[model samples]
Target: MLSNFLPFLYGISVFVLLILAAKIMLNGFVSSQASLKTQNSFSKKKKDDRTGLVTVHPELLNKDGCITDEDLLTVRFAKDSDHPQSSENPSE
Candidate 1:
């Protein structure tokens, strides 16, 4: 009786492994296809010269949607300031 159950258990284990492998492969293929589609679409489209994903999130845009001098200075300093905290004390 134990010998007869061996083949059935083996077959079930193989089937389950195959199912898991297929699921993983299908998920990978779907994600890759989606990424490819996005890349192709982005490549084909013309991006605005003045605006981008990085630019949009910045604090430069004013209430009127214009770049002011304060905004420009703030952005440049905030992003590229190497030494943010000064070694000198203000009370000194």
Candidate 2:
């Protein structure tokens, strides 16, 4: 009789756990909504330039809640075509 009652007890416990899991998920207790909000906020974030370039990082912000003014460093990459061709390398 005890052995037969064990399966029934297990089934009831499993059903209770499933119900709790469903309730937690439906109530958004896993913070999925908060993460989605942060992702959407980044998409709507303002850039430092009017050309829509140069995303200002959060670390660059000053204590006054503004982006600190600093010179932006840029490097011009030399394309292969822009490089001087050597005579040894036959130009196709």
Candidate 3:
């Protein structure tokens, strides 16, 4: 039984190593691709000549259009009836 298990164990260990190497290679490729994408996105933004200013437009705001997190905190949440409870368990 011991002799029979040795070859199977060796094969499984080799397979596991191969899988780990593949995962590392795939992760490196993905990381490099993501970095390149980020670089391309930044490069595409047209540089402002007036003051050499780089500005990012805010995605969320009120009617006044103040670009700040403090502006968002000013808004009030509704009563207990407005808050809905989920039926599904999040931990699972």
Give each model's clash number: 0, 0, 0
lDDT per residue (tens digit) for residues 48-90 in model 1: 5435544564476678887645613323355785855544477
Candidate 1 vs 3: which has more lDDT: 1
Q: Give the range where candidate 3 is weakest over 10 consecutive residues by summed lDDT.
A: 67-76
* lDDT (Cα) of model 2: 0.77
How many angstroms is residue 56 displaced in model 1 relative to the true structure, after the best TM-score fit? 20
Q: Quick one: ranking by lDDT, best first?
A: 2, 1, 3
* Cα lDDT tens digits for candidate 2, 1-92: 99999999999999999999999898885588888988788768853455767777887788987986765454557763566444356869
lDDT of each: 0.76, 0.77, 0.74
Off by over 4 Å in 3: 46-92
Clashing pairs in 2: none
Between candidates 2 and 3, which one is better according to lDDT? 2
Evaluated against the true structure, the overall lDDT of model 3 is 0.74
Task: Note each model's CA RMSD in angstroms.
Answer: 8.2, 11.1, 15.5
